[model samples]
Target: MTTTAPMKRRAILAFMLDRPGVLNKIAMLIRRKMYNVETLTVCKTTQPGTSRMTITLREDSDDKMRQVIKQIEKSTEVISARELDMNESFWREVAIVKLEADEGRLETLKRTYPFETLDSQGNGCFIVQVTGTSQLIDDFLKDAGSDSIIDVARSGFTAMEK
Candidate 1:
């Protein structure tokens, strides 16, 4: 019998107290549990003194993931932690890519990809913004070519249930 399960990507949404050291504590907890985090996005919510965090990682076992959530909820700073169902939830990521290309290539790229030009320098460097799913961003980067890309910054997956 097979002893290992295939690893699957998972996202956990956590609501926690908006105070100092809360992020550090939660990060330490996940780190100690040996889960590798792929992306983490945290921001203050509309509710005063509260914040929400969206963390994406890969895990092979559902039971172990639930156990990790239970452990996280035990923290005084965390209000709750639950896994988000990718099929039932809406998620998006934002990316800013800087590329070195001439005006003609830049125009061609703008027409080919769904990206907005944020700024352009006289030195043929252009900064653009694209917002979509992770896969969309990956495809955009790949299509843009590695030789033309100078830098990239991405805001990890932010998700909400339908």
Candidate 2:
């Protein structure tokens, strides 16, 4: 299957009180709205007492997404919240996929996926790193058929303030 629809990506930024359980509050809102999170990265901000989180949500209409953001801002632990577009901002995610890249297909895989040979010794395992837009990663997986994908770890969406 293929999609001609232009992918809609939104970067949601939140400044929350630096404390325990704040992450849970933020995640609950997304789950309640039934939106699948594409990526979620949280870290401390320059402000000594606050934490910043950037989350990327999968395909959805603008109005519905906006409603979710409003709910996030209304949370008691939330200091501020806003959604951003890729053009107006910059973000990156690291996808580490551990797969069985036997000697027969290593060369072909290197040519196709933007990845690095992390480890190939001892345990007969290899790790690949792919960094790009969500659509690109999604496309890569769709095309990477029958490769014995062992595991996939995405760094989620980490964005800089615009």
Candidate 3:
């Protein structure tokens, strides 16, 4: 017999009223259900007084996901909530990496990864911005080698339906 692992990532898109404490209420509800949020991005929408949220989590069952969505939609501030189909959606993340490298290594790094230099110092240090799928960012860091990396900051997944 073989056991299949549960889905490791799921995304929910929600439209809600832009008001104070709305996020807190939704977050608290999810927390009470014991679901761990992987990434959450909230931003104002084009509609006045409205906001859109993209929340990512790991869930094992479709029923549970539906229950979470229903619960979220019950909130006074929430207009609607639903799970996003990964296949029909596009996802992206942004990361800023600070590293130390010589002039020779810098050119090589640039050739390997598509990134914009945000800042640089004469002392062989540089800060660069990389935007792409999460896997690409991970690969860049892994290939860059840990010893040369000073720090990294990542903007969690932001998604949109196709």
Q: Between prediction 1 and prediction 3, which has the larger TM-score? A: 3
TM of each candidate vs. truth = 0.91, 0.74, 0.92
Segments of candidate 3 deviating more than 4 angstroms: 1-7
**lDDT score for candidate 3 against the true structure:** 0.91
Instruction: Write down the lDDT of every candidate, Cα atoms only.
Output: 0.91, 0.79, 0.91
Better of 1 and 2 by TM-score: 1
**Candidate 2 positional error at 141, Å:** 4.0
Tell me the RMSD of model 2 versus the true structure. 3.6
lDDT of 2 by residue, 59-101 (tens): 5588887899899999998999988777877787778877775
Q: What is the alpha-carbon lDDT of model 1 when measured against the actual structure?
A: 0.91
Report the poorest 10 consecutive residues by lDDT, candidate 1. Answer: 105-114
Model 2, poorest ten-residue lDDT window?
A: 139-148
